[model samples]
Target: MIIIAAVDDRNGMMFNHRRQSQDKVLREKILSLTAGKLLWMDHYSAKQFDGCTAPQLNIDDRFMWEAAPGEYCFVEDTSVAHFEKWAEQIILFKWNRKYPGDFCFDIDVQKPEWKLSHTEDFAGSSHEKITMEVYDHA
Candidate 1:
């Protein structure tokens, strides 16, 4: 499975069980990335994509365990570290700023087994700049 997440400058993803942030541009980017594919996300995360049309979505509480290989999982409150073993690729959309968060993105993409393959920055509707990093298993 391919893991997708949005993080603040400190790799923080959530605060008090809620997501740190959301942006219209980021949502569009995610939709574009998952086009023609199934994207699995828990019910909490599903609320963010309510009006989406394209890109099939599967809402399951056990999405992490249920997603098949090459499938996409948009993680919000969950700790993605444990699911690293099943991750073929990891995509992070960075907010480039700091936010108060309790749960953070825990995967050490710098580890020898995972390789940083691509990175790009774009302007977001709610944020000045958002960075994207794609890591693939080595």
Candidate 2:
């Protein structure tokens, strides 16, 4: 399966996007990956498409509901054992821990809080539109 994942500053691995391909070979890869899959990921990978009706999660590995909480383990491609090795690596590396405090080299480390916004909030240049509307009304 052509699964593209990234390890974050927290060492946490998030598998979110599946690349687009119509070739029979590519489709087979996807099917094999999700056939016995036990985890689902979000749409972080959608950014690659610049914006398209990309598949969020393959057939069986659908997304989790907003009101519900779910957790999944990430497996590396080179590993022999699937999810088991990935989960073990995460625990040993403390993937869930906070960002490291110090950096010996010239590296920038910033711990920022995540801001959740409605999809509509990104519909347009909202700030500019609001200002123009207010001026017109005035």
Candidate 3:
């Protein structure tokens, strides 16, 4: 499966069961990236995309397990360490700043098994710059 998430510089994903931040451009980017594919996410994560109907969204609490190979999963408030082996690619949208977080991203992209495949920085509605990094498994 393709894992997509938003994080801070420190890899923080959520705080007290809530996401760290949200950006219009980041959400649009995610929608664009997962277009024409099933995008799996939980109910809480779906709230951000209340009015959109372009992407094929699959809502399930067990989204990590439900997502098929080559499918995209928007992870917000979950620990994804256990699902690492099934991930074919990881796309991270970075906030470029730190936020208070209790739940953080588990996998270390610096590890030898993951290769940094692509990166780009763009302006967002809430942030001056949001960086995107795509990693592929070796």
Candidate 4:
């Protein structure tokens, strides 16, 4: 399975049960990438993609055990550490700013087994810039 999320410069994801920030351009990027694909997320995260065109699956804790290989999962509040064994890759959207956050990404992309395969930067409507990083799990 693959995972995707947006994190702040300090790797902060959310605060007070809400996303720290958002960008329309970043949302478009996600929609373009996940278009015609199966995107999985928990109930809370699902709300963020209200008008998304892709097929979305609202999942529960059993998602980790039930998701098939090659599936794509978009996570925000979900802890991704548990998916290391099954994850094929990870796509991280790095917002070029910091925000107060109670929750942060739990996985360590710096680990030896994960390789930073690609990176690209783009300006955002709500952010100065955003970097998209793709890490392949070996």
Best by TM-score: 3
Q: Give the least accurate 10-residue stretch of model 2, judged by summed lDDT.
A: 129-138
Off by over 4 Å in 1: none
lDDT (10s digit) by residue, model 1, range 5-99: 99998899999988899999998999889888889999999999888876478999999999999899999988888889899999999999899
| Per-residue accuracy of model 3 over 10-101 as CA lDDT, tens digit each | 99999888889999888889998888999999999999999988648888999998999999999988789999999999999999998998
Per-prediction TM-score to the true structure, in the order listed:
0.96, 0.20, 0.97, 0.88
Candidate 4: segments with Cα more than 4 A from true spot: 56-65
The window of 10 residues in a row where model 3 has the poorest summed lDDT is: 50-59
Cα-based RMSD of the predictions, in order?
A: 0.9, 19.3, 0.8, 1.9
Error of 3 at 121 (Å): 0.5
Clashing pairs in 4: none
By lDDT, is 1 or 2 better? 1
lDDT tens digits, residue span 15-65, model 4? 998989878888788877876666677777767667765554545645556
Q: Give the clashing pairs for model 3.
A: none
In order, candidate lDDTs are 0.92, 0.24, 0.92, 0.82
Error of 3 at 97 (Å): 0.3
